[model samples]
Target: MSEQPVPVTTLLDDEAFLGTYQPDIWVFVQRSLIIGFLTAVVFGPLIGLPPEYWLPIMGFTTVFSAFIFDDYTSWLNHRADVWHLTSLRLIYENGNAPEQNAAVNLADIHATQRKLYKNLRLDLETGQSVLMKYLTNPRAIERDIDIARLALMGTIADEADIPTAEEANS
Candidate 1:
């Protein structure tokens, strides 16, 4: 399987978001529910009240939107790439797209880095990184990469699969 680069905006498309079984779906939905609940708690009871009372609700909800929903929105903007590793090269494709963005020969890969913050960040040896946010289990992603790397190392390269350094030097 090859890995591909995808645009951050591609998340806006439903097909792109659901194509992969991103465990983060629950986290995103749960956070959204929390935001909705918090908004309701602060304002739902006061909605029918007088303007003076509803003022507080409006203020609280606004703050919640700015703070909590902002995080969610950022998560929503995030994207994850599913890479395909062949015998000789890595093929990258957007989890959302059918076409590949680019291919990196195994020998050129300087390093593979994974960052686990609020989300899962996959960085290629090429310095390109993809952020998969709000995932329930980030370790799984890291493990997959580790396995991929090992498998790639054992897989022999073919002339048609990728250009060798010797060939390049020639």
Candidate 2:
């Protein structure tokens, strides 16, 4: 049961906060390439933009559409996303979508499970759980959660920490 709790803070600057994480951009890049190809083949001729200008037009359209539409969501999701562990809670921020960000108190997390080896599922006390997927390295996050869980269980008195996976790896 992992219902999200209200976020007490938007983006924490405290050292305890693990810091913001931008998901891998490979998917976005691939999609952009596909969109560009299709635009050049179809929209270019249809718009009478000229054969010579097709590539430029396609490139502009691809980048423009991506940034305004696809990239906007992804970029905002990446930029606004935040996650961290505090003594009292396991915070997961999924960017501000209509201001829907929330947190989950550590004490409220009854269980944590790794799903499909790359997904982190958190079972909350309320019988609702949150699954964090597409995590570049779920193992690292899983390990951090475990450490924080241990700390929450009185195994450690000081504040807990979740180490960020290396940027290159993540």
How high is the CA lDDT of each candidate model? 0.50, 0.63
Weakest lDDT window of 10 consecutive positions for candidate 1? 12-21
- By TM-score, how accurate is candidate 1? 0.41
Best by TM-score: 2
* Residue 32 lDDT, candidate 2, scale 0-100: 67
Give the Å shift of residue 119 in candidate 2: 1.8
Per-model TM values vs. the true structure: 0.41, 0.49
* Candidate 1 residue-wise lDDT, 1-170, digit = tens: 33333333322232222123243456665655566556666666656555456546655655577476585456544444444444344445555454545555555554444454435555666677655566666555444444444446765343244333354347
Best candidate, lDDT-wise? Answer: 2
